[model samples]
Target: MLPSITPFGGMNLRPRSSGSGGVEEARNALGQRLRELRRRAQLSGKQLAESLSWQPSKVSKIENGKQTPTDDDIEAWTRATDTEHETEALLASLHTLEVQHAEWQRVLKAGMLGHQLELSEQDAKTRLYRSFEPAVVPGLLQTAEFARALFSRAIMVHRVPNDVNDAVAKRMQRQEMLYRTDKAFHFVITEAALRYRLCAVDTMLGQLDRLVSLTSLRNMRLGVIGYETQYVVDPRHGFMIYNSDLVRVETYSAELNLRQSHEIGLYTSTFEKLAAVASYDAAARAVINRAIADLASAQPEDGE
Candidate 1:
């Protein structure tokens, strides 16, 4: 979410979702440390790049937290800076951030079902949960059938173990958190999400109905941004902001846990802007009704 920490080619990097900005802060600190080392060694960026057989800008990017340093890069940097004594301490900090990133492969090493349980645990702890979706229904408001289709798709795409049923069950269990009075939920979705057709017409209609049903809950705020509304901010990827502490964003290849305050605040502002242009209450129901109407029309004629 804070731009990607690494390039797209190889196994990647991630930020912290704990919301204390620990990962981001540490990255910035690492960059500062690297820069201090370079300055202390009286080496220019160009000189270091030439010495390491790397691009000059890479040295600058790593020193500014715009890019993450690989282990090899770290080693090379320390050696170039004549700070070999600091390598262990610096790598220790990097490892702290690495574990928090939760690379998808490592996370799914056990199974997808466990991932759902892990999120369920997070659900139990969150006091205020805000989900902003541009493409699909948020899990907290998904129907059992719709959720099944999603898990099944994940199995096919990610090639994770085929534990769709268990994953579905765990998701439904997480949905129970919505009924808690002490916690509050806010959902902002584009109308396009409802029409994405992730499930059959009937199943999606049921999902839409579920959306309408949840609207009556006092603590839940459901907002649908219809096409009719003018642009607020250019919509980006979907993200879940947990109590102003952390933001979780899923990409095609990985899940990003954004812990930086500025990044979290940016999403909060984006959600509010999207919410401002969204249709709520009765107007929101009308939008849902329209989607349901279209789905019904796509069904076969009754007489046939």
Candidate 2:
């Protein structure tokens, strides 16, 4: 839980736009269904675990959505509860949860280019895109060179199959939406994000320059929160809200796709809070300029 803090009410907190809810709710729904089945069979959690020769915690975790059940585990559970008929339904929910939280290795199994293309498809149809970053620039605003450095870092960190060139190309292609006048874009980044040099000093300098240039676009709203900006909400991780409906949050293991209205609202609230304190227009450009100058000053030993 986060420490309580007052919120800034200056920025709008309404949902941005539309998107599919992914797994978090599905996991909870599945857990409730399993608990219902257990109750219907007149079995206590301990009794069910004992009958299946599994630890009681396993039953509790599965019932409360703390853990995901295996196929065999589910089979044993249904058989023990005489609810085998529920197997198909349970499996379907599990399947949805698994796909929604697909591990990075599986997502990049076909290499990074595939995911880039998938993102491109989504961006092409999105009417409004809102993104918040605690560190690093959003992909939609990245320069090709900066993206190459970022993807290369991903290859090293995740040890995924490297198709860096193709992936970078596809990512660049996805940036075409910046020119589309029909869609609205709102981006909020923290001072830490501007300071984090994900790329070499030269590339970062260029990236900072790009940010400054992007702010000039009529359809784009870029906000930058300074290092000392007051925090109403902690920016735990970077997230993007697509069309005000779907929120996508990436962590070390999986990308969380949030579709529930309250979940999306929570993110929307955070985005607005961050935006309220963020510098915009000339102020935003000054932030980028300051970053560029700092990067340039450090370029002697950092350009790679």
Candidate 3:
């Protein structure tokens, strides 16, 4: 059954302006919804605060969208205001936005290292990492030159960084998680994906060689899905499936975190379909070797 939503004592009821920036816009929107509900119920902020045993300032922050109300708070507010289904759903969306705007730097220093370190750390802890590569090599297996090329593009073309080398080094440092003694590693690749070179032939060759070496480790598993394979789940975009008592699927825009039983079940089902269509063990190694050979053959000899 859908939950109830009520006007929390502190939220404002006005629509947010278009000029609002960053997280403020989200908070303001949530505030406006709560405010409308409270007014409709003929409850003043002070009166509502009295009912909830909350300080007037707490209610004020919630109404102003400066503070996020908890699920319990929302439930209580909704009950107090006598709200129904649609109102509850609209209010629930605010929780998603608030959770998604994670401060990546803070997460990193707190030991997550943003998504990059977090992905590898989870893989190491769980012994499995299911990856779909639509465009480039997964960061965990990237070589220095290939990694540098990718970083150069981001820093120079995208203007996302001031120091290209520093960024590239950070990326390389993140890869160490894959090799940490405590966790096994599993990687799945596609033949077409491996063929699409991201750097010079030498760089691509080194990357492939690294892949070959890494896959040879007893605890490391590599799988290759050929273009000919028929996939039950034809996921065209790249995503990383992190398995560590939870499943996290990362996209370019947002990281989808799944811990709920139903959500985990869904991702597991999709991952199995992808695995079934992939080639593993020696067959996967052959694909990597072939790509490396093809890259070398295409390049001019060093003496020439």
Candidate 4:
């Protein structure tokens, strides 16, 4: 997936599950656990806050899942409530929640190849892939040269260890899933994505051509939203939905994995709205071909 065009925004470290309630449910559960510890210790919220030198509202926020507790906060809370034994378990839960909203640097700690493998594992489990992009081509549909360009930029920007070759190979390997008869893919991209000069003009032209060819796959659906189309919902950022179960949102700093049913439904609806205004089939090809022609025409003549 391509990074969002916007600057890094704060992330919600709340826990999420496969259940209907998703993040809120998991958050509330963690909060409830803390609340139970306090209650068992015979301490009121006000008393606990005062004991820990915290504002009374901090207790409420932590207990209500509005605020995530830091390790120090959890340790202090457990000690104040005479439930120190539960400290480790609570910290474990907190770490689990934190993993769901992983910073890109940490995710790429082992290098880009590791991250690509992680994506491949996720892809292996998904039977239906619905992707929407406003900034660049979706990773699964990206050609090798285009993928290399994107990966190179990511390496330079994030200052991660260089593994472009291995990472690109893994990404290309993942694309093999596209040929599987059991899976289906739906990709919606904006005309602006086609025009973005993220790579050499020649490489982008090849990528656009790749998109044109991908449209003919029996199980794949490609949608292109031209600039002339009026917006229904704001195309905030690109996201991928995997089989109605998971929504992967990439940001400039991190990746958000949303598993809540409601969140998935929201993205699903948004994708449908974007797809509705897209040009598909022959129209989609025409849009892609136009981009190709534009790039070709703009190319400098030999010796110019």
Candidate 5:
């Protein structure tokens, strides 16, 4: 007999699991909308789950967006809550998300990860990229040499050997979105980043030069908070804010995304506090240039 297998080849085939930020965002948006409707209907999770013959845990999963609801679940929910028309409309709007998290083979076969990512990210009207590093420049502003060194370190030491060239190229390509008339990119970087030298002396100098050059763009802004300055916003984690609609926090094992109003408010406030303490314009540039010079000077004689 043929081995038992799922129609999708036993793969989860969930759209949010595709490792694409765009797909993830769409999934999250659907979840947020579902929770809002549930709240508006005044249906406690238990009540909703019981009415649909589902476990409370399952209801929680659907609302939290940990799991996607099938068509039957959606119909059951809408009918039970007396919001069939509104729910139907919401489902139509989110149909794209239903297929967003496709399998990796599908993406690879299409050979368009970069383009697809660009399309997804571009859908956002605005973006704010925040970075904190014990060492090394942020990828968005990194020079080729600096990027190579950093990738080597991450791959060799951290064992996260992403395709360095492909990843770097994707990052640089993403920067173009800042210049587009439709949207702009905002950057927040830690001063400690300026002090770190990930590559050779010359490469570090080149990277700093690039950073200085990019600072003049009208669509982009960079801020640096001196390490000696007391920080009012003490974030225990490092996160990136996307389009003011999503917060992505990073950890060694996985990433956490926050879209709930309460969490979003917390990060917004945290970012503002960090920005308040940061130095911008000439002051920030001066700090970066000085660090570059200091790193260059610390190198030994050519023959040594």
Candidate 6:
């Protein structure tokens, strides 16, 4: 999904905020701590850089949060500042920051096509996919038109490079895994997903038709949580659980790749709770059909 820092004894394990600002803020906090250590040793920036054999700009960048320090960099900084005891804690914060938050601008730097390919690689390694979506269809189940619409919006909103056609093609390519007998897919989506007007009416209709056809697949199980179903747990956000180990959660500005055992367990339990209240097979198709009917009714007749 996406890719934090803390203090010596009081490490800020959680992000300060939900946006990319939180990550940037955490990095700045780390830099401030390192700068404090340097000052406590009575070393000027250039002197510290010289002692560490790093360029003066390197010290400035790290101290300004413009550059993230490597493990070795952290070690050298701690040594030069006579704050070696802080090394372990600093390293822990650095690793946590690297592993937890991945901003969209950086993740999509090469373009959306690259991100799609990376997701494809992830899917290839996963045998059981359990996804819950409260807003839109999961990437694996999205139609080309729907995917195109989504990618176009992302490009505009995130100001990422425009590679919509390539990205859409790659997403369609990823769908080939659906037919693999070795893998199984179980997706639970709220009825709101089907009714969300993210794309044109015709495209939405076609997308719902695709969902209907997919329901009969031997390796795929689709579930629709209708409005009438009472949720056992609050569907706070959408997430995908790959097997039993990892959970991929997407936010407005970043993607969260949660790997902790407790985090995975919580999501797994949440998915089970959502899936239990959902309708499957014919019932799931009925939900899709209803959405299609609603859209069709809204369309003007041939004469008007």
The C-alpha lDDT values of all candidates are: 0.77, 0.76, 0.61, 0.81, 0.60, 0.80
What are the TM-scores, per candidate, against the unseen true structure? 0.74, 0.79, 0.61, 0.79, 0.58, 0.76
Task: Please rank every candidate by lDDT, starting with the best.
Answer: 4, 6, 1, 2, 3, 5
> In candidate 1, where is summed lDDT lowest over 10 consecutive residues?
3-12
Tens digits of lDDT, candidate 3, 1-304: 2111101000011112211233456667877888888899899999889998999888789989888676787777877788865456755666665454433232323222243444445544565666655446677677778766765543343234245455456667766666666666666667866777456777778888887877767666677887778888765444455563454433322333445555456556766677778887788888888888888888998799
TM-score of 6: 0.76
Clash totals for all models, in order?
Answer: 1, 5, 7, 0, 1, 4
RMSD of each: 6.3, 6.5, 12.2, 5.1, 11.0, 7.9
Colliding residue pairs in candidate 5? 15-101
**Taking the tens digit of each residue's C-alpha lDDT, what string does model 5 give over 1-304?**
2111111111111213213455456667777777777888999989888888888999888777677676777777888888888776777745555444433332233332343364346345445454443234555666766765655444453344246677556556665665776555556667666665445778878888887887788877777777777887563444456666666543332334455566556667777787777777898888888887788789787899
What is candidate 2's local distance difference test score? 0.76
lDDT of 4 by residue, 198-257 (tens): 789889989999999999999999999998999898677777889988887766666777
RMSD of 5: 11.0
Clashing pairs in 3: 5-78, 6-78, 10-59, 10-63, 11-63, 12-63, 108-113
Estimate, for each residue in 1-304, the C-alpha lDDT of model 2 and write its tens digit. 2111101001112123322243655777888889998999999999998998889999999888788787888788889989899899888878778766756666777777887887787787789999887777888888888788767766776678889899888877777878888999999988777776455777878888888989999999999988777888776667788997677766555555676787888788878988888999999888878877887776675456
Of candidate 4, the 10-residue stretch with the lowest lDDT total is 6-15
Query: Deviation in angstroms for 225 in model 5?
Result: 0.5
